[model samples]
Target: MLEAVGLSARESAVYQALLTRPGADAARIAGDCGLAEAEVGAVLLRLVQDGLVVQSGRPTRYEATAPDVALGKLIGRQEQRLSAARLEMQRLTQMFRDAGAPGDAGQVEVVSGASAVSARVNRVYEAAHRQVRAFDRPPYMQRLGENLPLQQRRQREGVAFRTIYSRDALALPGRFQQDIELSCASGEQARVRPSLPTKLIMADESMAVVPMAMGEAFAETAYVIRSSALLAALSALFEHEWSRGVPLVAGPRRSSEQLDQPDEKTRALLGLLAGGLTDEAIARALGWSARTTQRRIAALHKELGVSTRFQAGAAARDRGWL
Candidate 1:
């Protein structure tokens, strides 16, 4: 319990033993705390130097200082250190302002360690007011679950959240469907795509956290990008993928006419494409000339406002026409 105050487990045990028995010798503390006599001696020396235990009497007896007194001094020292750090931060901020280039462009930070990454994620979420766009998948920090309440609170406060999940992520060994449904119920727009380029979380289009390494196993190391052209490129990638994702939650209500009305032939064309059929095979199945089939396929692409067959299938699925 006192480890935060610079006490090791053995030191805490010896201190507690001394507190319980006012004038215990090293051997007595060792037996009581289940420590070796030599270890107890070393712990007692450290405690004495830390001012939590004092040496007294003939053979160097040990007694613990009152908890209130010892902890008060430790707290004072910590506050002094914090004050010094705050002053140093102010100095650095001013120096950067004087010497740094204008705007936040090209500013990037590589944050390592799981705890540090979690802290940065929380920091970004707290600073976001307008929108938070996220690409989420597996190999997540175990502590990521703790942020749900914060997300819900932000949703209540009118902050927009849009999340895209990989198809595999939703199929993991958990009650993910129920959890996702709950999230959607609370105003988060969600979508699913077969795969994603990377794990990303962008705040208000100004800042983003992306993996420094390629795969899920390297989730701990991340790059925090500030406003830069690179950030814009990341935003563009997200938008492109988002356009090709199937909505898991219902989007804004649209009139029936607003949804593209592709007829049965158009549906059949897309279904054949989605099934990996060749153009010739599709034409043979439909009993149409290859030229006519190609023209219809081109027309279908134009109707869906997508150039690629994959995007066409994704758009069809997103609009519930397939």
Candidate 2:
């Protein structure tokens, strides 16, 4: 444990020996700690520098400081060094900010690695005041583990939070449904679209983060965009998609009877339909033939007492089916 306070193995052993034999010299400490006299001399010097041992008298007697007092002083010194480093970091950051052109459109930052990207994301939400708009999908580097609490806390702080998810995002592994549901329950407005290109997280309309590449290269790299026309354009795109997204937990699932009538498959189909998925896309998702999917859609419409697909959607919504 003394090693944690900057003592080497020999130094800690020597200190322990000194505690047991307070006025022990190097020869005596070496005997007790199983070290050679030369080794004991070097270890004692280091322990003295670390404030764990004190030397006194002409014979250079070594004494151990009380553990509590010595460790406390060591911790205080370590904390002071840490504080100084933090101040230096802040100073360097400010200098960099001052050196940069204000509001530079070309001020795009490339963030690489999963952990780095995740940290940048957490920072964005931590500082968000007005609102957070996000486009969520798969190829995720990290789960929304840290985001859950921050969203809930921000919601309580009255910072508007909304997330738009792709239908496929819900199907990806790793507690996707539970994560989204928990956020929605915590007052985050969540919606689902059938598809979304890339991923985006925009906070307060001033900054945004988006993948530098899309589709197959989604998780490879991302960009942090500052206040610029590109940021505005991304925000506009989010709003456009938000206007088209279906609330993941909007209104209700279905009337009690209507809910009991549909199995998981039917419910999933309804959700995809409500998300505005094309039949071809739905067929691809469900691994059904086009004809089979059409039949199912017709049957679904018939079950809802609706004639056209649009009416089916309306009737479904009216019955709390979507």
Candidate 3:
């Protein structure tokens, strides 16, 4: 609970022990927590500073603040500070968001430990007002996707999203593609990218998260980072890859051309090309001449200002056009 609420392990243990004992002195606290007498004294001092522990008597015995009172005080102080910081952030965020991005940012937040980092990652998305970008690679998708809603409620309010999946993700065959298909039909942008690292995000320039370590299997731990520079780099990266992603037919809302004129064939061909399929394959599947298909594909790319049909499709889908 200590770590979950953003407390250090030692800090939480000491605080909880304090609550149980009520008025344990330094020596007793040391014995209970298996810490040295001096260490106990130091921890108590920190607790006092945090308003969780109070010092009394000439020799300086320590007492735990009432749990409710102590927690309330801590929460209140944190809230005040957070409010102030958020206001300041809002001012700065306005400037940053308006500046068209001035390269990378100067600040970085490195959240360590795997479980805590993962939890924080979920927090970032939960707090996002814009779109959430997922750099999904393999089992991470299967596992993490379970925790994520298929379409975030904010998307209903106009939060645009773009997700990049690796080519190998197709190895999952129909099942995974079905999920991707489902995502597209809901309100998400999904495209295939090449080899990728574990990255998570919430909107453009809001937050950028990546694992601290990238092992072939799973890294024992990960870090969730939130910083301006990191977010900018990740944004550029997402855009670059998104520029190379394919298109899929979007939800009924993004692609509703009445009953008889569904635009299904064109959209399906776009999906295949966005997945990096060739014009020849697209033509074969669409039952059209390769020349005609290529001409239409080129026309689409030109209209979208994307060099490749894949980019055109990804961009189109992201904007709810395809």
Candidate 4:
């Protein structure tokens, strides 16, 4: 047990003997452990440093501390030292790990290239199974890279990341700037940026990495980071950058106005639909043939990008264009 915590063989022997009989004088302790008195005293001093025993009395009598107290103290000291040692080791490990390729070591994998990188990012998006905590900087969001539009639409689907972006990414004009504005008008989260780049990806802070090489004509390299130390460092960097970002302007959206101010016929069609007008009833009421009414409803659905007329009505209602 003593050896387990790094005690010398002699130290273990002397310490064990002291425990078997706590009040044993140094001479008796030495004899009991088959050691010379001077040797016993030396080992006892070592044990003291090891927190296993202490010297008491003016004559320098050594007494063994209670096993519970001694063991607890020893283990606690060892654990503290081990924890500090591990932290230093982890820091060094991160340095080495970061220097190496971030290819999947078992379950973990690192991918590169804009398309491949977007695929990797989309894993987080599709898997959002919940919310998207977005921190989309303009340049990155607008990076006319491959598959940008599809990715942005998918990003806007959920509540989390859109707000972070709509509040921030919309301020700068470039790519998806209008989308950001549209989102902000929808009364979702969208903020403006004082400054930031087209880089950053983090989902639940469990994973986060930025492209070390961005906006280059060719190859894109992601500085994939996973270690808690590194992840924490990156998160801190994001938060610091986020703090400097501008707050989003809360105001009415122009899209709502555009959607509301349709032509009179479009408005009449929408109003009829809003009043629960079916195709047959709308056709009869508007004195239009059934085919024409269905065509108009179909066109309205196409225009609104809704699967159902109710959804169109709901969207119209949401935009206050009803």
Residue 316 displacement in candidate 2 (angstroms): 12
Alpha-carbon shift of residue 205 in model 1 (angstroms) = 1.7
Candidate RMSDs in Å, in order, are 13.2, 7.3, 13.9, 17.6
Q: Assess each prediction's global lDDT (C-alpha) against the native.
A: 0.74, 0.76, 0.64, 0.59
Model 3: residues >4 Å from true position, as ranges? 1-114, 141-145, 148-150, 173-178, 216-220, 250-270, 277-322
Predicted structure with the largest lDDT when compared to the true one = 2
TM-score rank, highest first? Answer: 2, 1, 3, 4
Worst 10 residues of 2 by lDDT: 93-102
Query: How do all models score by TM-score?
Result: 0.47, 0.61, 0.46, 0.35
Structure candidate 3, residue pairs in collision: 105-229, 246-274
- Report the number of clashing residue pairs per model: 0, 0, 2, 13
Candidate 2 per-residue lDDT over residues 220-256, each given as its tens digit: 6789887788888888899999998886643234457
Rank by lDDT (best first): 2, 1, 3, 4
